[model samples]
Target: MRHLTQNWHVNILGFVLFLFTAVLLLIADNLSISYKEALTFYDEKNLLHYLSNLSVYFLGQSNIALRFPFILFYVLSVILMYKMTADYFKYESDRLISVLIFMFLPGIIGASLLVNNSIIVIFCTILYLYYYRTYNRHNYVLLFIFVFLDNSFAILFLALFFYAMKNRQNQLFIISLILFGLSMYIFGFDTFGKPKSHILDTFAIYASIFSPLLFLYFFYSMYRIGVKGKRSIYWYVSMTAFLFSFLLSFRQKIYIEDFAPFVVVTVPLMMKLFFHSLRVRLPRFRDKHYKVAALTLFLLFVNVGVILFNKPIYLMLKQSDDHFAYNYHFADEIAQLLQKSNIYTVTSNDYKLLKRLEFYGIHTDKKSTNFISIKPLNVYDKKFQIDYFNTNILNIYYVNLKK
Candidate 1:
């Protein structure tokens, strides 16, 4: 009874801490539209139109409702992450260390706070890994269903990699072949249709830059343990993936939610093995002080690096206007202008603007002229919506209402 009471107290405390973190994160700037917008843009577009529609269903067409569903998903993801850390590193000490590592990691924390696709990817990846580690079976099939939510070829590839990790060779091979075919079709590779650029070229470029490094690291770690047939396969998969990402990363807009998990899981395992090697040669390399110093230095460098790279980007993005609000303001101004102008369909090269306007319940069939910039505008042609503050755009400016 006493132990149960203590456990309850601990659990309650944990929940309180979790809620505090989540609430602060939830309040951060909402620069991007939730997955709800993407679905609404492409699909039948009912029940899931705005973030508010997730909780309190206000049937009014003004595009506002309760936001609890999105908030709930974010909170649930953080709680599951806590549970995963507790399970994977079962020892009390290890669990504490793992949780600290997760809390400090820029990618993990930044994704948790946003309504972006990355959080969905994080949830799916964590759940899949947890189930795989726990059941050691094709339990990943259950997890793969959620992967479609992320729209990432890299994640689909990672899912196939997970399937291949099992001892069942026949099952792994069949799954891999299916994934290969599916990837080709969905990603605009060969056979599905011709992409603007060759998929093989992208694969080759990423592979050349990152694969050799990943392979060398994998080989060095594995060689220490006598690399045999099945164990060696892991490196091959890692390299193949690294190659795919090298091309994908160049696009700059590709979200990390798509591939961060692969690095998070794989890197830790590699480091663990590296540390094990260091331990074996501890006496020759250094005494206790040196070993501690090395580990501390390595961790410090990683912590600093993660912060330097991730925080500024997340902050800048978080400070921007939420996609819905930005478009909403723009549309209201346009609607006022439309009252005076005879124009209806605006030709816009900006895909995001088109999507954003649609998300805010503004109707326009943004047609684009062949010229990328400044072509003759017909009096019948509609005005192109432009945000005045965004500096990259020079030729476009918002004509004020008084004018």
Candidate 2:
């Protein structure tokens, strides 16, 4: 009865943590539509990001509603992360701490609110990994499903096949190879093309995501895991995947979603390493209760500091109008103005802005010669154009075309 009650309390605490994290993400600036989000909305390339588009299409196209699917997937991924951590680490506190760190990661938070396939991919990846680690059979179904989520995930099959081969799981290796071949046939071998050089930009992106301090800790943890841990294959696979993603990021336009797998796989390992270091260095602390309390408080402080102080995190939480492609605060007003004026046709060099306008129910006519061109009044044009909506973050002008 005592153990059961204690478990209940821990579960409740984890639920509360999830709720708090969700609320913060809900209120963050990234919840609004951005250029990348606009691309997802248009989806001209017909990529495998059907889930993201389908979610938006079914969810009423509202700013807040569009985020719900991603949030739901994000929560699911976090839960799976906890399960995976619990399975791997004996210490209950370490499991909880790992989940907490995942919840607070800036990359995870920002990615969760955007209309991108990354969150979904992360969720599927974690689920597949969790099942791979815990279940002895029926994991091939997950591999089959993952091929549809993103072509990049197909790389994981190679890692799994290698592991299976090394461990003498010949049946699993054969299945993985078959799936890999099928994925290649369907998704094509295009992802393996020559890499572009984005070495500096990629490094900058990683630095921003993990922050300099956390990145250092992550690197150190990877080093320790590779050198000391028996399950070194996991570390090698994770690093290889990260490198592949990093190199592929330059070959094409990749977003944070593309890096979600790398982040998901590494963060828990880093947390485990951190806790192990704590135990080793503070072995003299006699009171286990006090030690847990101190460590918990320290981690909470660090997470809070990261949220408040990190430049990207600060911007995400600030909720500025300029953060989005269309000024969300003034969206309804702009829509109303355009509708009232009977300005159905519009043109703009800023395609993202046009897409946002369209999402808000303002249609654009590319062929119409005399349509309104929405542009910044001061910056884009100094000529006499009717000012439609003007704000610190955005400016709109109604220019009459000579028909």
lDDT of 2 by residue, 253-311 (tens): 45544554555567777776666666775556636635654665465456555553333
Q: Best-fitting candidate, measured by lDDT?
A: 2
The C-alpha stretches of model 2 lying farther than 4 A from their native spots are: 1-5, 8-15, 21-25, 28-30, 42-59, 189-196, 232-236, 246-256, 283-345, 367-391
Query: What lDDT tens digits, residue by residue, belong to model 1 across residues 1-403?
Result: 8887656634654765576555433433223343345445345343333444443344433322223344455455555555654444323444444444444344544454443455555556556555655566545464345433434544455446554665456676566566655655655331222234454544433222223334345445545533533343333334444445555544433333445444433433454454455567847664764655356546544543443333233234433243223332334344334434543444355555545445444445533221112223443223344334452211222222222
**Cα lDDT over the full model 2:** 0.62
Q: List the residue pairs that clash in candidate 2.
A: none
Each prediction's Cα lDDT score?
0.44, 0.62
The regions of model 1 sitting more than 4 angstroms off are 1-20, 23-26, 29-75, 81-90, 113-115, 143-168, 186-240, 247-257, 267-403
Candidate RMSDs in order: 9.0, 5.7
Cα shift from native, residue 3, model 1 (Å): 3.5
Q: Local error of candidate 1 at 158, Å? A: 6.1
